[model samples]
Target: MVIPKMAQMVRCRIGYFTLKCSNRVVPRVFLPLKYQRLCFHTSWLLNVRGKEVLMPSLSPTMEAGTIVKWLKKEGEKIEPGDAIADIQTDKAVITMEYDDEGILAKIIIQEGAKDIKVGQLIALTVEPDEDWKSVELPSSTSIPSAASVSVSSESTESATPPPGQQNLAMPALSPTMTSGTIVKWLKKEGDEIEPGDAIADIQTDKAVMTFEIDDEGVLAKIISSEGSQVEVGQLIAIIVEKGMDWKNIVLPTTTAPVKSSAPAPSVSKPAATAAPAGLKPPSSGQVYGLAVKRLLEEYGLSSGQIKGTGRVNRLLKSDVLSYIQTNNVQKVKLEAVSPKTTKADAASRISAAAGKPSSYEDIPVSNIRAVIAKRLGESKSTIPHSYSTIDVKLDKLIDIRKKLKVENIKVSVNDFITKAVAHALLECPDINTLYQNGQIIRIPRVDISIAVATPTGLITPIVFDTVSKSLPEISETIKELAYKAKEGKLKPQEFQGGTFTISNLGMFGIKEFSAIINPPQTAILAVGSGREELDSSISPITRMTVTLSYDRRAISEDMAADFLAVLRAMLEEPTFLAVKRARNFMNQVE
Candidate 1:
C-alpha cells in the first residue's frame, strides 16, 4: 500500500487499487504485473474520503444516480448507518446510509447534482467536529467549488438545496421499466409545489401517469426536454436554490429508448375487450400518451371505469388489458357527461372548477391497496382459489386474551387466533403445503404471515417457525413487522415465504369478510370484528366471526373445513395450544 503525500493532486479512482493477499504470494512473472502496478488493495476499501458520495451498486443494472437530496446537511453530525442522502436510483429514491460517523464538511456534488459515475465522490465528510483542513481530500478529476458547501451556521440547513432548485431524476417506476417518456410538465420551472403536487406526467412502458413531490419544494429547472426518453435515475428536472448555477451540473445523454414491437391500438377506438358493467371507459382524449393509449385501445377498455390500483393511478396498457381478461366481462358504455370535454379542456375545466390545479385532487393508492391489487390480481388469474368460511364463536379466545391482558401479556384477539391456527397447522400438515414450481412444495416448518393494515398499505410480516414460537413471540413479531411495513421499510424477505396467512381487521370493527388468498401461499384467513349481541338464547354478548380463503388447487374443501374445525377446537380450549408448545413445534402436528 502506498500513500500519496500530495493531497491536492492525488487522484483517487476506483479500480486503480488491487488487493494482494500477504498470506500467499505467487511468482512475479506468473502474476498480472499490470494489476499490481496501481494503488492500495482490498476489495471493499473506499479510497477517497472527503469527496463526493458515489452511486452504490443497488442492483446489477444501475450504473449511476443523481443526488436527490442530502438527508444530512453539511456540518451536521452523522453516525454510521445514518442515512446521509436520498438518491434517485434507476428504481426509486432510496436512502443512502453512511458507514462512518462524521460531520458533512463539504459537498463535492451538490443536491440535484447530476450525471455522476459510480465510485465518484459527491461529498466530503470528516470526523465530527474535526478540523476540516486536516481531512485528506483527493483533488483530481473535477473539483467542486468550495463555496458550494458553505452554509451560515444560523441558516436552517437542509439536505438538499431549497425546493424547486434541487434536481430529481426520473424513477424506475416498475420492475420492468428501464426508461420513461416525459408526457408533459404539470408544473413549470419556478412553480411552487407542495408534497403530493403533480409535477409532471411520465409515460412508462406500462402506463402514462403523473409523478408527485415527496416533500414541499419549488420547481427550479427542467433538465431533459419534454418527450425525451430518460433512463431510470437520469435527472429529469432540477429544484434547488432559486438562483443556483447549473452550468457545472453535467447530465449524461438519456439512454437509448427501450423499444418494444407490441402494437398499440388507436386512441379513438377502444380495444376489443371492454370494461365491466358500471365501470367508466377511457376515451381517446383522456389517453395521456401513445404507448398507454395504444395498449388501452387494443384491450378496448376505459381507464376511469377500471380501477388503476397502482401506487398512483399510473395505469400501464398492460394493466388495462389484464383487467379485461381477468374480469371476463365486456365494457359498459358510460353515460356521456354533457358535451364531452377534451383532455386539455378537462384540465383547464378542472382547474377552473376546482381552486388551484396545482392543488389537484387525486387519491393515491395506499401501500395496502397496491399490495392488495397485486395479490388479488395474481390470485384471480393464476391461482384457482375457492374460499371456505366457518363461523367460530370466539367467547373462549376473547376470554383467554382478557386473562392474558390482566397478566400483562396484552395479546390481541388476532394473536390468540393465530396461535390456534398454528396449532391447527401442526395437526393438519397437508393444509400447510404451498403450490410452487408446478408442484406442491410442503414446507417443513410452519411460517405464518399476519396481515397488518397501516395507512400506507397492507403488509404481512412472518411469524417465523410459527408452530414452534410461543404466543407472545408470534405476537411480538407481528407487531414489529407491522410497524416496519407501515413505514415502508419491510424487506421483501420479511413479507415473503409463508405457508399460510392471516388477515385480521377486527380492530377496525369489520365483521365476517372474505379475503383474497395471497399468492404462493395455499390459504389466507380473514378475521373480522367480533360483535356483542344476543345469541340463540337471546342473551346479549360479544363474539367474533372468521373466514378462510383457501387455494382449491392444493387443498380440497373437506381438508380445508377440517383445518378450520381443528382451529376452532384449539381456540375453544386454550390448553390445546399449550400442548402444541410441548411438542417442540418443529413440524406440523398432523
Candidate 2:
C-alpha cells in the first residue's frame, strides 16, 4: 500500500471562534551537500561480490532472520557451511551459516540488533587481502525519500518545507513498552542535537532509559505526554534548524493533537447523543458515571425528566417506567416488545435482582490463557471422556533423573515422566488416536503437549517430533518452549497440533486427580506428586499415581489399561526408553 504524504494543519476552536484550516509544513533543510554524496558512495558497493548466506529459518514459516549472536570471531577463516551465529526470527532459534572462503574482516552490525530486514546489510567481509573497512558507508538521509517539515512560528506566513519525506519513528526498548513517558527535554526549539545525546528519559515497560537523538539538528517539539502509552513506531519528538556540518532532520507534519491554548467545546454527536424532547439534558458531571446514565443516553432519554426512585436520587429503570407512566405519551404492553428486547429486559431484571449496581473485574488474558480457554472449552463440550488411574513405582525414574542431573542434563523428574508417556504413545498408537468423523485417526507422529501454568491460566505448548528425539533433546526443547509459553510469546504452531497432552501437578504436592482430555485428541495424562510410602513389605518406597483421561468413543478400556501399563514400565525402567531413543536417532540419520 502506498502511504500518502499529506501535510497537516493545526487549528482549534478558541472560545466562540472557529478557526480555518491551512496547508502548511515545517520549514527545515533536509540534508547538507556533504551528506548528499552518501548515496553515490554506496551505489558502487551494491554490485561488489560477497558471500551469500542461506540461514536456516527458525520458525517453520519464517522467511528471514535477525542475527542475535556471532559465535565465529570476525577475521577468522572458516570452512563451508559452518554454524557462525544464532539467528532468532518470530518463532524459534535457527543456525546461521554462510559460504566459507572470505575472511570476516568487519562486523557492520553487532549482536542484539534488530531491523535485519530482508536483504539488509548485516555485516561486511573482505576477500583474501582485500580491505573491507575502506568501503564508504551511506548516510542515514541517503537511504530515504523527501518528507514534509512542520514550521511553528508566531506568524502564519512562515516558509513551508517541501512534502514527501516520512519520519522514521523512535526505536522501542521492548515489545511491551506501549508508551514511553517523557521525563524531561534536554534541548530547546533551536539547538543542535548529536547522535548520542540524552534527549529524554523514556519510561518504558521496564525501567526509564535515556532516549538518544539520531542526528545533529535543533530540537523541535515534544509530541508525547510524560506518561502515556505510545505506539511501537511513532515520532515522539522532532529536530529542526539544520547547519552545514550536520545533516538535516525532516519532521513529519502529521502529529497528534496537542493540548492547545484553545479548547474546543465537544458537542456530542447527534446520532449517538440525541435525547428525547421535553426531557432536561444530561448532567454536566461525567459523560458516563453510572449504567442508568448510559442506558438513558442510549434510549434517547434525558436524566432530569426521569424521576429517580433509586438511592441518593440516582436514576433507575423503574424511575424511567414511572416517568413514562406518569406521562400519557404512549400506552404499550410488555409482551409487545421484540424477543431480543425482551431477553435484554429479562437479563437486566435478573441483574437488578442480584444486586444494586453492576460490579465487574477486568482480567487480562494472555495468549496462553486464550489458547487454554479455547481448547478446554472445546474438549469439555465435544469429547466423550472417561478416566483411569494407575499407581507406578517412581524409584527407577527418580534414580535416572539423579544420574542425568550429575551428567549435566538438568531436567526435572516431571520431564522424565513426560518422556515415558511419549514412549508409550509410540508403542500403543491406538491409545493415541482421536475420534473424528466416525473414525479413529491414529497419528503416526508423537507431539506431546505438556501443561504449563502461565500468569493467566494453563497452556500446553507441544514438543515437536517428540518420539524421534532423545531424552536430553526433549528435556531441553521442553524447557525452552515452556519458558516461551510462560512469557506469552509461544507461536500458534507451538500450542497447536498435539497428539497427546500431559498435565503434571507433581510440584503442587497434589496426590492424584483425573484431568479432562483436550478435545479432538483422545487422551490426556495427569501426573501427581510422587511420595515415599511403605509397601506390602513395610519398606520405604517412592511411588507416583498417574491418571489417564481418554475418550471412550476413541479408546477402549483394555486399550487405556495397556497404554498405562507400557507407560508405567517405561518410567519404571528408563534405561529401556533411553536405548530405544538412541536406536531411533541412529535409524533416522541412516
Candidate 3:
C-alpha cells in the first residue's frame, strides 16, 4: 500500500490500473469516438466520462454487468495494470485492470450487485494528493437520472441471482453468445453429477450443446426449466458438494446476503414434516416448483395428470418431467401462455420506440444480430478498405477432387481453395497479419476464419493451423465447424480469433462480389461462382473469381496481388499439396 503525498505531480494514470483478481477484463466501456472500436482493439476503451471512472462495458455485446467480487479493498493502494475486481460480463467473469496510480477510495456498487449499467459509477478513486477516506460520488454522474431510476426499479423485480451459492449460471458457450435457452437438463434435481457428466443441454445463440459439470456435486435445484430463455451469467441451477446439507440450502433472496447495512438475518428453514414449497410459485393453488409449474402450463396439463412423488404430495420437478416424457406431450400455443404478457404490451413498447404501432411488420433484432450489425457497419465506415480481384484456373484442382472422390476421399472445391490460401499466406507472410491499435502483427500460423451463415446471422468459425492440415482434414474441419455454427454450438475457441477470413458465395450463384473485412484481421477473401471461358488456344477453361478485401493500412496492394498470384499457381497445379501429403505420410512410415 504505497501512498505518495505529492499534490503537485499526482498523476492520475488509472485508465490502465486493473486489480489482478481471479476475474479481470478490460471492458468495452471505452468511448467509441469517431467509429473507433471498428478500427481495432476493444480492450483500451475510453468512454465519455470526462474524468470520472465508471462501470466498463466488459464485452462488445455487454450493456450491463454484475459485480462478482472486488479484488482490492477500499483505501488500498493501486498501481498501474493492477486488477481491482472480477466482473461478470455477458460472457464470463473477466478481470478489470486499472492503469493509473490512485487509491481505491470507495466502491459505489457492492459485491453481489447485478445489472450495473455500463458507465455507471462502480468505485471512486483518488490521486495521492487527496484523502482516500474523503472521496465521494461526484455530482455530475447519472445516479439521479431517470434511466438510473428505471434501472434501480428493475432490480426489485426479483432478488439478485445468488453468486457463490454454487448456482450454475448460463455460460457463454461462444464468444458472441449473449443468452441461451435450456434445451434439456440431463440430470434432475437431487441427482449427483460428476465433473465430466453432461449436466444440461444448453441451446445458445449458436446451437444446442451439452454443458458438462466441472465439479462433483448434487444438483439441489433447477431454477430455469426446459425452453426457458436466460441471459448469460444469470443463474439456472444450484449445485452442492457431496455430503453437504443441500436439503437445508436457503432459497435465494435479496436479503440472504446482506451488505454494509446489517448482518443478514438467518432465514428459518421450512418444516420437514409438512409440504415444503420451493421458489415462489406462479400461483397459490397447489403449484409445485416454479419450473414444474411452467412445464405444467407449457404442456397444458393439470395436476391430476401426474402424481406428486415428494413428501406430502409435493410434486418434484422430476415427476412433472417424467409425466411429460411418458405422454410425449407437446407444448401449448403461445397465446395459451399467461395473458399478462400479451401482444398489446409488446405493441405498446414497439410504438414507444417507433412513434407508431410498428409491431405488426417489425421482427425483433436478436442480440447476436445486433452485434453483427454494429461491428459490420463500423468496419465498413472506419477502415481504409481496399479490394483486388483475380480469376484462378481450377481445372487441375477439379481433377484432383475427382480423383480423391473415387478413392473415397471426398472433398470440396472450397477445401482446396482454403488450402491454397493457407499456402499462399505462408509465402506471403506480409499479408498474413492483423491490424490492431495502429500496429500490424504478423501471425506465425495460419488460422482461417471461414464465414458460415446461420438462420440468425453470419458467424466465422476458425480452422486453426490451416496450412498444416491436409485437404481432407480441412474439408472435415470446415464441415464440422459449419454444422456447429448453423446449430449455434460453436465454442469460443472455435470462433474467437483468426489470422485471415474467407467468405464463399460461390454456391449461391454470385458471379463476383466483395466481402467486408473482419476487423483486427488483415483481409478477407470472397470466392464467387465458377464459370467456363475460352482460353487463348480456343480450349475451354474453368476459372473461379476471388476478390480480396484488405485493410490498406496494414497490407499493400502489391502484397495482396502477390498472394493471389501464389494462390492461383497452387490451384492450377494441385500436385504440390498432394506431394506434400504423400511425403509426410512416407516420413511417418519410415
TM-scores of the candidates are: 0.45, 0.43, 0.55
Instruction: Report the C-alpha displacement of residue 489, candidate 1, in angstroms.
Output: 2.2
Against the true structure, candidate 1 reaches a TM-score of: 0.45
lDDT of 1 by residue, 141-170 (tens): 454321222211111121444323454767
**In candidate 3, how many Å is residue 199 off?**
2.9
List the lowest-lDDT window of 10 residues for candidate 1. Answer: 149-158
Tens digits of lDDT, candidate 2, 127-157: 6554444433433312111011111111111
Q: What lDDT would each prediction earn against the true structure?
A: 0.61, 0.58, 0.70
- Worst 10-residue lDDT window for candidate 2 reads 144-153
How large an RMSD does model 3 have? 17.7
Q: What ranges in model 2 sit over 4 Å off? A: 1-371, 436-439, 580-590
Q: Indicate which candidate wins on lDDT.
A: 3
Whole-model lDDT, model 2: 0.58
Better of 1 and 3 by TM-score: 3
Error of 1 at 224 (Å): 9.7
